[model samples]
Target: MTQAQSFSSTIFRRKPVVGARAPGQAADEPHLKRSIGTFQLTFFGVGATVGTGIFIVIPEAISMSGPAVILSFLIAGIAAGLAAICYAEMASAVPVSGSSYSYAYATMGEVVAVGIGACLMLEYGVSAAATSIGWGQYLNELINNLFGWSIPNELTAAPWGVDDPGWINLPSVILVVMCGLLLIRGASESALVNTIMVSIKIGVLLLFAAVCFTAFTSSHFSPFMPEGMAGVTSAAAVIFFTFIGLDAVSTAGDEVRNPQKAMPRAIVGALIVVVSIYLLTAVASIGAQAWTEFSPDDEASLSRLANSVTGSTWVGDIIALGAVISIFSVTLVVIYGQTRILFAMGRDGLLPKTFAQVSPKTMVPVNNTVIVCGVIALLGGFVPIDALWDLVSVGTLAAFITVSIGVVILRRTMPDLPRPFKVPGYPVTPVLSVAACVWILSGLAPVTFLFFGLWVAAALLFYFLWGRRHSKLNTGPASSADEVSQ
Candidate 1:
């Protein structure tokens, strides 16, 4: 065989260098602006993290552990915080756009990157769908409060919803499409919009907490651990979905100003704020109503709690309006994260070129955004919210474990590489992160694990059949102009 043929056969091998850019692309893409700061990045984390689960996951979590769900929040928060720290180290060290997918590729190998990319797609894409479903619920609540009527149940609910079965979820599809349109415009505008949404979301949650406390009764604390330690850990696994977007901060590593100082602070700050608010809300909610009264089928449980506590529909209307706005922002951010991950994979030759194409007019990957919106909208329109949540949690937990392990591997392989933020406890920190993730993974339902296994296997099969043969590294080194940017 000739030399060229021999070189082609080595496609299965890993791409060793970090931050490898595509051939002919400039060091800085002309379209994507690097204008995000610490404040903007923190909001990205907060905006993405809070709305996805809190708006919808509360009743589901309450059903799982009763009043002990507060402890579950703390457990999930710590696990997420540790994983985010490890994520910061990888972000600062690699300085890439793919989030965990890029970090896995640069440090682990091509195969691992492909696997993690699959998990991230599920994490962000399904998260977008789930949040949109939640948004639809809040929109219904808002309309009912303001106009004394809502869209017909047949048009607003998925088929699996017990109370109402619909042919399609119209509102969720519309919301996802709206977010996609905004994303196609550009990233800078999205960041500004997200900051505003974050403020509104935080303000409303605080208002709800304050009002709910007026109805607080100490008797609500009697049976805190209804299901015991087992229930607390299980609820933590379920609530883990809320923290999935904390890593969105790290995904902006290449876009942030002064990443070394900014990244860790933004991540930690977001975690603290998110966890504190969640705990306060959980306490106030159970205090306002009996834990047994939290109906798992109610998507707008928080608003309902507010209505019950204040004996009027006015407060519930305010909470619902805030949820509708903030959940829209959360959907936008997660969809943005999904598009970027696919774009990075395309650049490296793991997927189709259309994903990597950045439109000259907008400086964003318009094609990728559109594709993500199409898929996510379909899921949100047809799939039940409960069906989507566990899948998101499973994918996110697996991806977090991969990131924690990657940190340990990079430390051993490239000890001298400069990391803007290091995991504080060294090997122990990453190890504990991995352990926590595994424990959470164990708590997931067997059906969830089975579905996750099938999804991952399909992803690996695709890589072996197509990705290995078409990789950019198989061709040759990237052009000097497009060499990996530091």
Candidate 2:
């Protein structure tokens, strides 16, 4: 091969399911411990996803689609559900840490892997930051209701968030740090804590739903689809990040026990729970309060709605408390997913090796966790939450599209590959998954498209300059076209 052809081949080289890691690496070479089960895995998805968007997305969705925001929820849920099915198949077949990045690497090539990795990083990292920002708001609300005091706006606000700008978001910074500490201890501990948080939050949301329903009026939902299909889809795009955690389950492929069975179950289970709760809450909130009354400025909108419906501060306090607990779990899980993605990249030599180093004592990527926390803290503290949400949805939806495409590619390229969980409809399912995600993508703002394009460009540039030269597949012995499993 000519020099140019050799370079092209190196860039496009695919990792095999087997021997994709450093050649001769032992089966027990200390990857993340496989301790997470189907149950905890489901909570990881619910925990990471629910708190981030549900607490805030209702008003945002309502602001766009009016009472028809309920339909927007369904649309986003369907798209997310479809993509999650594809993710299950990929996670089962690849059974790796990087989520779609790992899937793309094994099925597509090194370049696509880098691109997908960038998208996943954006999804998890930015969502963590954004969710943490909201955590600060709920913390203040809880404190205010319980003790007649709250964090000062100056300390609680992000400098960049024009909606309620402040010098720094102290509560958000603290939340990010606290979650990072929990993650450093180990995944099992983190998962246990997250599951508890998920339970509490779900119960709180249900309570809110029941309370709001007491004041339900059929008149509120009369002009459903007020924004038409365009409005519903646009709202769906805005709130799509609420469903982002479903893929967090796939990112745990390396740490999951009985991954082939656990992954698909966890993803589907989490999806059902998340979607049901969101729809219920949306219906109740809209039924009790006119959709026109939802203000984007209300931080604890659900809690306020409860307080208004019941005419008591105590109920709102409880909801705020739940938000505090649940958003913390969201931060914890998202940071965990982000670190694992970096760990996968590090293992591939696409990043500095320190990121891949699992601490001997904890059996987790301590260095990777710390780096993720620091970056997330900075973003959460300084960036406006408003700026982060759509960006997260854009990255997540893009990654979802990649996973759907990867399913089709893998099925054709490796038809007999062991897939413990096949997407039920085969070609139709994956194709629909891609189309659904694309439809959601169409609703994103032009500025979001520009920013995402720039982010992808930067990621590709880094790959050529640094990751390309250091990638393990470029230096390791050739891989066998065989399967590896957790």
Identify the candidate with maximal lDDT. Answer: 2
How much does candidate 1 score in TM-score?
A: 0.93
Encode model 1's per-residue lDDT on 132-217: one tens digit a residue. Answer: 98899899989988998999888888887765689889999999999999988888888899999999999999999999999998
lDDT of 2 by residue, 216-257 (tens): 999999788777888888899988987879888888877888
Residue 16 of model 1 has an lDDT of 48
Model 2, TM vs. native = 0.96
- lDDT of the structure predicted as candidate 2: 0.85
lDDT, residue 274, candidate 1: 90
RMSD of 2: 1.9
